[model samples]
Target: LKGQIHGGVAQGLGQALMERVVYDRQSGQNLTGSFMDYSMPRADTMPDMEIFSNPVPTKRNPLGAKGAGEAGTVGALPAVVNAVLDALAPLGVKTFDMPATSERIWQAIEEARA
Candidate 1:
């Protein structure tokens, strides 16, 4: 169970920070056609993850079941995005899109300063 949760959170963080599918504008061809060209989250790139849980018994079901399969990925994307935006707030940045790479972040800062 712990492993599953960790894997899910890692996957979620990857999608939030690094995963993107690029395409050719003219031919509509997939630009990210190879794994080498695509960016995936690596162990060195991953953030420290801390998870906490509190289970509550439900009277409606005898099993007292709760679904958590997609919880990690579902929560991570927005959390990461919000964190980025917040960090940049002091720099006069208010809006940003996803997959906020280093280049894009630098560009946003430059644009805001100008």
Candidate 2:
């Protein structure tokens, strides 16, 4: 269960911070067609996670076990994005897009200053 959640979180983090589809505008070719061109989450990029499980059995289920599938992935994207936005709130950055790359964050800061 813990491994599942961790894996999901890693996937979510990638989506939130690194995953992007790039294309060559002139040729309409997919630029990010390979792992070498595409950015993905690495071991060093992942934050230390502490997961606390509180199991609540459903009355409908005989074992009362709930599905944990995709739970981590579902929660991670918004949580990471919101956290970044919250950090930038004081800088007048009111909104930001997904895959909050370093370049994008810097752009947001510059825009806020402007």
Candidate 3:
């Protein structure tokens, strides 16, 4: 479920620093339209991820094994965003608005340049 991991992180990143879904006042429609119009995380934006967690729980029927699903997504969001910040730290780019689009990144880059 690489898609799930990626998608969850995308959602988390949206919640973290980007524009989230909100109602359109005039048309009463969703603000985010198509995938292209949407602000999404890009491939080069994130660093490698390290995932780890405690063993499956044992609370039900002597076998409380936790599901493997949702685990990766749970682990990936923070790691990816953290890596981005870490990469930009040396440039004094400490803050960002998310989904970290090229436009936003470009603005940050320009700000850093200034």
Poorest 10 consecutive residues of model 1 by lDDT? Answer: 1-10
- Tell me the deviation in Å of residue 89 in model 3: 2.3
- Candidates in order have lDDT scores of 0.78, 0.88, 0.63
Q: Find the candidate with the highest TM-score and give its number.
A: 2
Question: Which prediction has more favorable lDDT, 2 or 3?
Answer: 2
lDDT of 3 by residue, 1-114 (tens): 444455566556554455455568998997677775565556677555544455657687666654555545564557656877888878878767765656767777778878
Tens-digit per-residue lDDT, 1-114, candidate 1 = 445566677777777777789999999999988889888777676667677778776678889865567667777778888899899989988876568888778888887898
lDDT of 2 at 26: 97
* Candidates, ranked, TM-score: 2, 1, 3
Residue 12 in candidate 3, Cα distance off native in Å: 5.3
Off by over 4 Å in 3: 1-29, 33-59, 62-64
The runs of at least 3 residues in candidate 2 whose Cα sits more than 4 Å from the true structure, single-residue gaps closed, are 43-45, 55-67
Preferred candidate (TM-score higher): 1 or 3: 1
User: Residues 10-112, candidate 2, lDDT per residue (tens digit)?
Assistant: 9899999999998998999999999999999877877888998977778997887666776789988989999999999999998777789998999999999
TM-score of each: 0.74, 0.80, 0.51
lDDT (Cα) of model 3:
0.63
Greater lDDT among 1 and 2 belongs to 2
lDDT for 74 in candidate 1 is 74
